[model samples]
Target chain A: MSSDVLVSVRGLEVHFPVRGEGIRKKGAGVLRAVDGVDLDILRGETLGLVGESGCGKSTLGNAVLRLIPSTGGSVHFAGTDVTSVGGKGLRELRRRAGMVFQDPFASLDPRRTVAQTVSEPLEVHGLRSGRRERAARVGELLELVGLDPAVAGRYPHEFSGGQRQRVGIARALAGEPDFLVCDEAIASLDVSVQAQVLNLLRRLQKQLGLTLLFISHDLSAVRHISDRIAVMYLGRIVEIGPASAVGSDPQMPYTQALLSAVPLPHPALERERKRIVLRGDVPSPSAVPSGCRFRTRCPYVFEPCDDVDPALQPAGAAGQQAACHLHGVVGTPVERTPEGVTAEP
Target chain B: MGARSGAPRGSEPASAVTAGTAPVLEVEDLRVRLRTPRGPADVVNGLSYTVGPGETVAVVGESGSGKSVSVLALLGLLPARVATVTGRAVLQGEDLLTMKPERLRQVRGPGAGMVFQDPMTSLNPVLTVGRQLVEGIRAHGDVSKEAARSRAADLLGEVGLPDPKGALDRYPHELSGGMRQRVVIAIALSNSPALLIADEATTALDVTVQAQIIDLIENLQADRGTGVIWITHDLGVVAGIADRVLVMYGGRCVEDGTVDDVLERPAHPYTRGLLGALPDLARPAVDGVVPDLATVPGTPPAPTDLPEGCVFWPRCPVRGDARCEHEQPPLVQIQGLDRHFGPSGLPHRAATWCTEPTSDTGLPASGTGSTALGGDR
Candidate 1:
């Protein structure tokens, strides 16, 4: 809706129908994977999307990229309604927006060389004049991601996991897209390699002036890379704020639990820190709980949480927000100490 | 903690072996080769380590570092037709490397147990989870089916699985990823083996699930007095559980010491590079758009196309000249519990090359006929 916004998703819902023979399940049953999500990614900022497994974080990212069709609402990219765009319009939109997948080994064609893998997008968009120019551009792209140009002739199998991911990044940047969605791109890599790739992505984003929608289940990694973070729970945004604010002082119960679960690198801190372990496993999306999706496992859940759904409201300092009744007077008032002081447990 | 007291007492003395008291599973000069189209490709070479009775030893390295291959070779799991293994893998006064096929099969489930990377692939899809656990139990022990089923249920419960009775009747697909991994652990622990090898057991699971599974494995080992050889590439997982850490590179133990010694003050150049690359929350943030991240350039050399001297010399950031390029640096103990590649194959010595501090440039000079010490290439 605004010029500064690169991608705006409002109430976007992606649901798949589940057919069964029992209990009025003919047409009423539907698996609401990505249900009613609202997010805004600015022009050149990295917006991180995080959640546990089966919490619909990946589904939401895919739906925003228009890789998967949404059942309801709209996605507006640079003032263009991507949901209504089709045929040539969709193809044009794809050129301006690219996605880097989780598994680099599976995403790249095994038969293609590194050069071909990076140049395929350029060929598809018909951006290059001749083979020579395309080859040169591929070499430059490889170097941009810290890979050697000499490695251009090698196949994907010859490289390690980190190198393959670099190739994937080079491919994503080939079409000169303004916005990119990296869905768990670093999850399959080792920790050391993960840091390298994350650093590379940040450098490339700044150099190219690109906006990134980084989706991952790893909290520490997302905190390191994101400018602002949005915490998702069962296809809904429970909290949205700056990365530092959300990580250090979480307002929602879900956010608090998620941050607490991350083990600190220092052994002393890890031993002293209290972990908020949720009792049960995550509920299935097809049978999501009514009202608050996290109410089933929320540690601070009460009677009011089951009946009334809380909307996203300002909770943290300044512009941060959270959708939880704890901040309100409905269940228990979140006790706050004096300014700049943390309430002791 | 309450869990610490629940640990079985018989295994307590075995933990001292990691303190150089007595080694349980000792492997020396272990070498494994496969007959490829390009002649013999050494998958595991000159790997040496010891896992005490109750100590949890971690062999950490990237893929193809010979961690998994060495463990599989010890159990005689590699196919005899394609692979040729040599050297000593002594377990409870028996040489596993020289044992007969039939004898090895008998010793596999009882003497040593193994859990693979992916539980779904390791388990049979058509068979029920209960039947699989019972099969592992009955394969080595003399027990009735009813007794085995009950023991299987208890094992499942020990792994923190909900409704062990109900889980026994369900197939692998019905359970979640975490639940399936718990079932695999139950199967691995069914025989009460003295030694357990978990090869990337929790690498496929989510972070929370990974933590839970690691805790479960550590608990089980404490109770059973089972020596553990945890093979993984994740440093985070290794830091939490390992008593002694062995840093492997290009099929050799480059560094081996206590977890605190290796993690806090890593002496090997490779080990230091790996630790420096890790994103620490406690560290101060770097300026500029991109943070200063340590990355080793070039890929690990393939086993078939390994360099002549040190296998890591091509990618080593602190690459010295003639010694690193002309002769293989043997694994030698360095100053104060640190181990690294050195010229002489002696103990209690540091690497022969300069012990200069690592610079922030992230890339050192390549070995270009210039030696740190005056030597011929």
Candidate 2:
């Protein structure tokens, strides 16, 4: 691992067991939300994770932050294995990392004031020993997110959607953490309000020298904020590369189709662009296809894709890697997933 | 006009030339006042638009912008007590706003169909997909149960559902989000309705599924010449699907024009701001560096507390004129446009003070917010 790597994850798995009918024993079915994934977030670099629902991008993000327990593998943060930490070590880890959720409406407590929400993080970390100092810090954090400090006494319902999201950011940044994970942070906001929040986040990241793991299903929104992009399929990363390369010339067929499916706002360009529409819906994670998880919907499916799962290998572009057998090195034997039925359309 | 004459014609789509005349639905000075806890709020204030046969008119706006409410009013779906809808909604020849309850009910399914964002909103959880589709079909015609069942299967096939025969036996919960949406679309189209009002129908689906649904709707509309009202906040979907676009802000039609005219050469500052906010995939970043995203500061005003002046005056980046603060702007025709999407030839219009040479926006004549946004992304 490089010295600049702030957080590293290896072979992470988050499988959820399914139950039959009303109350049967743990069924044979296991939903592999994040199946054996490897990822790394470099210091001061924004890593964008993109995928559709049920693709495990959110689970991978939550696991890296240690917000949820992982089934297997490891997550290393600042030279420590976060997955194994407990008690004081975990509390210290929480102080060092923060997260911003997708829905501001649900994430915030309706009863709490903005100051209380922001100051609670400060109190939990035992920072700013006095109440006055904590209040000042809360005011500063609110201003940093472009909200008025005077409004800190108001409840979330008193503010607009954009303002409430700013309060959420203030609470997240109250920890003064070096790393932040924004999981669809701006997805719930309006198009105009989304830009304001995006700008605030970019400015904050640069100002504080914070590394961000920006995860979103909206491809267009994530493309601008991310330095590097990672595309996730059923439960695994299929492609990872610079944002420009991934947006323009994606190596994996799934990424190509995903990018193509996003309709551009430009009328002339939208009409002229060639769309590579896939055949069917994404297969259920419980019954994932054998070999390449994306092969079931991949237009460039070949013989090796039927049984041999391709590993991420160096692509033609610099610092780019893809898991498709078509672009990467062949003959490397990887574990094969069980055979499964096709998706129901 | 009654249901028969006002209804859109057969499967053959009308040509571009015939679209300007004989509009299927014409809404004139449409207004809706909802009795809220605070007070009576004017949600839709004199909003107007016309949808011709085979044309898809997109009503684009964010939440609380009254895009959805206006359509509900036109269809007489709003409750009488909670909402006071006063508008001239002429469908074919009959006035929907003045029609009796029985007449309005008759105009709902066979005359106009509806698709919502959540497929479950339109589907019955306990009933099978086939049963719901059959019920909707049988309600309009004198068809037998077996005939309606066959038609329901055919509708499912048309919406691209796999194994249409087997799907008839499955409940709504048995299908995926995309499949359930397809089933809903099948039910909506079962009666061969002349009009379809889809309110964020594909917003919940994934992009791949959204693309499929968009294509399906476009194909169905073209073959059947169904007039469509697509209510959404996503501009990308509008650019791809809409023949004409009506932009709503604070329950008013802020901008109205053909898709090419409105999207490519937006005249209103609100429309320009909306375009600047969205990250355009086609707009390549200069040298490897992405420009800072443009933003319109502050949020839309609440319906109850809307400004007496221009609806967007509070958040308008190009509030160049002094009159903008004290007076409301009318929907004026935009002048000196270089090109037009001639098919609709529907004159581009905007309800703003800054779309003209007289306003002198003090920015670029292009008015695309290129400089304000530190070079558009």
Candidate 3:
């Protein structure tokens, strides 16, 4: 366990047991939602875990926090192996790692006031000295997320989508956790409000010096906020690199395709740029392809791609890593060009 | 095939009917106030814009900016008991606001059609996609059921749905989000309405699906000469489709111009902020944080509780003194460009007393010779 790493996940796998109704009597099959994966988040940096829906990004985040028990692998946070932690130890681990859910409306207890909702974490962690101290702390937390402390008395329903997200942020920060996992936090927000909340998160991350794992399908938002980005496909990291390098000069065909699909705000650029429309939908996690997970939809798939699963290897001008057969060719640096970087023909 | 071969020039008819000049849909001074228990609360106040035939006009604003409300009012879709609406929604010289219910119903499917956000909710779960599409066609036209069904399948095929016949049999729930949206589009185009109002129609779908839908709409509009009113908050969607852009804030038209004019050389402060705030993929990343993303602080003013003078003054980053606070800014013709604050006649132009020179602020040089945006009154 590295002390420098805030959260280190090693070959993490989460599988749900599915029972067969007619044919099979015993355990029928395992739904491999999260296949073997390894990732690490250093102190005070945002590690973006990005994938399409049902790619198990959320499941990975949940499993790491020990909200859901993993079928295999270890999650170590702050020099503690949390995979086997139970009861008090698990509670302590949870205190050091908090989760910010996707839907602010659904995640929050509607009946509870803002103060109560945020303070619940403090109470659960047994950090508060008294009711008065907890109240004050709640006020501070509210202020930290750019919400008025006076609004702490109000219910969640009274606030807008952006404000409710602020309250959710306040609650997540209540434990003063070293690591925070924001799972699609800004997905539900309006574009303008999304910007505000993202800026607020950036400010808070710097101020608190907190490590974060920001999970989202929004490539633009993820590229904006993440220091390092990990592109997930079928419960595997297909590419991992610095945000700028991955965004500007993507080596992976999948990453290039993903980036090209993002609509540019400017009319000139939007009309000018070529869009790569990937054929077919995202495959189900349970029945992933045998070799390369992305082989089913990858534009550059060759004969060898179906047979050999390429591990994530270094590519690009910078030391960006991508898992693709093209990059797997021996002693050949995948040259980056403006046309080559684009997914569209 | 005959219709395709002998079809009138797509762009000529709309331009010709109104002397090759008039807009397909011209909304002027539209106001919608809901009759609440307390009083009439103005949801959409004084909104105006035009959509040229075969051209797309986007109403860009945040959630409660009255973009949706104004369109709803135009369509006569709002429940009369709840909403008291006043405005001139003229479509090809016919005032929609004053039309009787029977006439409005006749106009609805054939004259104009609407595609709403959330295709899942908008579509009927119990009915097959075919049934719904045929129903829309039969409602407005004296067509046989078989003819409508074939037309429905053809429409679905036109929108790029695979195995249109099979898809038609499937209920809304059985289809993917993208497929369902296509079905909705098929229904919207069933009557072959001259105008299509899509209110956040593609917002619910993923980026790839959204691109497909936008392409479908653009293709259909080009082929059919259908005028489209695209209401959305996403600048990206607007950039892709709209020929003209209308920037709405607080139920008012702050800026209206060609896509290039509004997107590249945004004049209004609110417009500038919105453009600035959008995370530009082309821009170089700064310290892992995207730069030039400036957020307009404070929430949108509630319709029932709008501020005096400029409704945007409270949140406007460039707001100046008492004039902005006391005197309501009217949209005026600054140079040749007409800028109106509210939804009245194009004549009632409003430039803030504290207008700043266009050169210093990166605004387009005014042809109307109005004072700078931030100049003192």
Q: Pick the candidate with the highest lDDT.
A: 2
Residue B243's lDDT in candidate 1:
70
| Better structure of 1 and 2 per DockQ | 2
Better of 1 and 3 by lDDT: 3
lDDT of 1 by residue, A111-159 (tens): 9888888998889888897999999999999999999999999999988
Cα deviation of B78, candidate 3, in Å: 0.9
Per-residue accuracy of model 3 over A1-345 as CA lDDT, tens digit each? 566778888889999987755765776667788888888888889998887777789999999888899999898888778888778888888788888899998999999999999999999998898999999999999999998899989999999999999999999899998889999999898777888998988888889998989999888888888889998877888889998888888888888877877777677677767766666666767677877888787766665577787787788777789888676445265433432243222
**Who is ahead in TM-score, 1 or 2?**
2
Which consecutive 10 residues in model 1 chain B have the weakest lDDT in total?
B341-350
lDDT of 1 by residue, B171-268 (tens): 99988887898899888888888888999998877665665676678777776778889998876667667777788877777777666555654556
lDDT of 2 by residue, B1-377 (tens): 11121122222232442345688788999999999999989999998788888888999998999999999999988999899999799988889999999988778887889999999666899999888888888887899999999998888888889889899989999899989998988888888877899999999989988887887887788778888999999999998888889999999999888887788777777887788888767765788778876677778888998998899988887676776788888887765443322335567788877653322211224442221111111
User: How many Å off is the CA of B50 in candidate 1?
Assistant: 1.8
Per-model TM-score on C-alpha atoms:
0.88, 0.92, 0.89
Regions more than 4 Å wrong, model 3: A17-31, A329-345, B1-21, B286-289, B336-377
